[model samples]
Target: MAGRIAAVSIVEAIAADLRNRIFTGDLVSGQTLTETDVASTYEVARPTAKASIEKLVAEGLLDRGTHKTARVIELGPESVRDIYLARAYLESEVLRRLARDKAVPGDAVLANSEIAALQSGAPLDVVEPDMRFHLSLIDAVGNERISRMYRSLVGEVRMCMVRVQSLHLLDNALIHNEHQRILELIESGQGDAAAQLLDEHLGRARERLVAAMGGTAGPEAALPSTLD
Candidate 1:
């Protein structure tokens, strides 16, 4: 039993390493990962390397080709659109509920702190405060299920932020202003208006990114069941 647990831990470590490489663009889209390379690089057995590859595949960080080789999955336009659209749709609800039922003072205090930090010259790449600001809004709804759903999207969301930053396309001031505006609307009990602003904010970001990436998938397809 201890051996099995130890093996799982090793595989998880390998997966974590490869995952970082993928998200950081060290191992880019469609790059193949052979089991031999994994074993030699990580000094693990073949089975361990294979397990690591499978773990990454499950996380959508890699894909298996017809020849059964693991390759990094490309973040296509469709995927990007789906990520942002769903986020906007669901997050608008968080803001909407915040307008109707959520307490304003606590969330406003937290959001204002983030805005102040941005005003004080904090870099946008430092996403901790940014994440906290947005997450606090979602969390204010007091729905564990909705919050849990947003948690699942964090990885992709961060991926987009990092990629945009790398491409020199991220607008720090724009994002800050938009977030400040949304928070203001929410605290003012303008739920519908806040939701509209949130939708436009996410929509424009998605359109800008997908257009830059050459996606023609009509911006977004059907939403996942989580949206419903």
Candidate 2:
């Protein structure tokens, strides 16, 4: 049992590393990965490398092909649309509930602090605080099931965002402005309006990212055929 658990942890760690590479565009869409290469790169056993690749396949980040090859999964237009729609639905509802219940009374203050942190030249990770802000809103909704789903989906969402950031397509200022608007709406007790704004903000962000990636509107389009 302990051995199995250790193997699982190792697999998960390799999966995370591969996911980061894919997200950062270091591994482009349809790029083939061999177990041998992965084992060498990660300094793990071949079986462990295989397990890691399989895990990414399960996460929709890779595809297993014939000849014992694993290729990065290509996200098409439909996937992009679906992801954005999911974000809009989940985040908007969370904001609405927070406003209606006055659950996030300190939202403005928190958001402003996030903005300040971003402006402090801390790091790209620090600049991407919108996810945390949205998660706080999710917590306010008080739904364990929804929260679980949100947690599961967040990795994919962050992967997509990382690609957008790599392309320099995402505007931090615009994001900060949207957050401020949402917070103001929530603080003013306009739950419905806040929800609507959240939807529009996310929708526009998706559209802009798609446009920046040459109007492909998908992960494949966002990624190059090969990494530089």
Q: Summarize candidate 1's per-residue lDDT along 1-228 as a digit string, tens digits.
A: 999999999999998888777667788888899999999999999999999998777656677966698888777778888888778878887788888853564754565466555633323334555666777787777789998898777757766665665665545666676777777787788999888877766766666667668865243222121112
Total clashing residue pairs per candidate? 0, 0
Best candidate, lDDT-wise? 1
Q: 18-58, model 2: which lDDT tens digit per residue?
A: 98788667888889998999999999999999989888877
Residue 157 lDDT, candidate 2, scale 0-100: 72
The runs of at least 3 residues in candidate 2 whose Cα sits more than 4 Å from the true structure, single-residue gaps closed, are 65-68, 105-112, 119-128, 216-228
TM-score of 1: 0.74
